[model samples]
Target: MEQQQIKLVVLDMAGTTVADQHEVEACFAKAARMSGLEASDEAILAAQGLSKRYVFQLFWRAQLGESHPDVETQVDKSYAIFKEVLEAHYQTQPVFPTDGCLKLFSYLKQNNIKIALTTGFYRVVTDIILGRLGWLEGLDENRIGNDDSIIQASIASDEVEHGRPAPLMIQKAMRLLGVTDPKHVINAGDTPSDLQSGNAAGVLLNLGVTNGTHTVEQLIGHPHDALIGSIDEIINLIEGIKQGRPSGKTADAYSF
Candidate 1:
């Protein structure tokens, strides 16, 4: 199949752009242990692409049962512990950008392709993470009045009615970026839901990166236009796709 032309690129934060899964998991485990609750990595991993509030609710429901009394109180206490741990550790062990991310952003910007960001994280948490990573430091001061300006625009879960597997956030990002045709936008993420969102949005290109939580084999079952192990591989794939050159086989052809 011929590659569809891409005009805008939408990126998912957390696992997709930042490399801090281990840190996040450790923080959650510590919080769970402190609360006298057992948290397994598998359970945490399953909630990878969900909002913080939703994640908290999932853990609460899992540990305290579906109809536990004072569920809100317990959830609040657990979340407080989680926040404390995250704040203390996130600053010291911030998430690092994936390899070639800066280069890819620069290349796309130079090529006049609009870049947008969408995340399951709330705006406040997003702000905190970006501040901790110093991601805005490399941008031009004139262009970015504040840290938020580092991105052309963003669609946070807090603003969207439906989260991942809904495509509302992706659609919102495309609209904010003035990308009319879904076929002209490329959605890149690390989860099956991410691919589903893009596919549901009718995006022309859906690129899955194995650098995040999901493996190549997991993404293969989804409708991704291409699959790569790292962000660096994206540039080459995009170039090939643009020139009508075959990049490689589907995700099914590659083992995790």
Candidate 2:
């Protein structure tokens, strides 16, 4: 069998690789209730793809009149509570990798393609989740080893100059991976912001998966090169692209 010529694969965490949406929402609700605020589901959904600190700031500003009273302190408290909730649930029901995740990752690794993990999660929370999943082994120092076939160049929403709608993270990932041409890379995620980031980064492919909070229709309107139901579909699309098959229209070519 001929090897595919995929250079890099950038994956988003949270809903894309792990199914922690329910847990994340529960934690946010618990934190909001502790602060004597009632956070609506719509509010929580809108806060998706933002850092926990930013989410807390949004809630604090809405509930407490302003982001005053020390926004960092409030963020710290909310995150602490969120971690407690995560630990309680994770202790009994640990988060497992999404279906076909292991197999797909193994396949990509075997093919010697570079893998980059990008997420809106903070380093603290990301560390905990990766540790639980045994992904920490790859994080020795700032650069994860490619010998394991999985590399993470995640830019936390807080760490970057701008999150999502901006392409700094993806650009940094490409630079680190030595991929100069955007056409040699594929960015996969479950949100419109993910597609936007990939598009802004000038990546060759911006793939959106419906496994996240967004519906297929919602993603269709976004600037994604292709929309699929899951990451497994992304793998199939990559195979098709490698085989000289048409992968459908560019995001801009689609009409709503």
The numbered model that scores best in TM-score is: 2
Model 1 ranges off by over 4 Å:
1-3, 137-150, 245-256
Q: Compared with the true structure, what per-residue lDDT tens digits does model 1 show for residues 1-256?
A: 3346667778887777777566677777788789766668888766666665667777788878989997778778877888788767766664678766778877776667767777777665666677766654543422222223446665678788878878998888776666688877778888777888888998766788887888877778888877777765666656756666543333442444
C-alpha RMSD of each candidate structure in angstroms: 4.0, 3.9
Cα TM-score of candidate 2: 0.83
Task: For candidate 2, write residues 1-256 as lDDT tens digits.
Answer: 1223468788888788777656777777887788665689777866766666677777877776684776667767877787677556655567777766677678677767777777777666676776677776766566455556355455556667877868877777778778777777888887778888898997767888776777788678788777766776656666766666554233332323
Global lDDT of each candidate: 0.72, 0.71
What pairs collide in candidate 1?
Answer: none
Model 1 lDDT, residue 76, Cα: 80
Candidate 1 structure, TM-score to reference: 0.81
Clashes of each: 0, 1
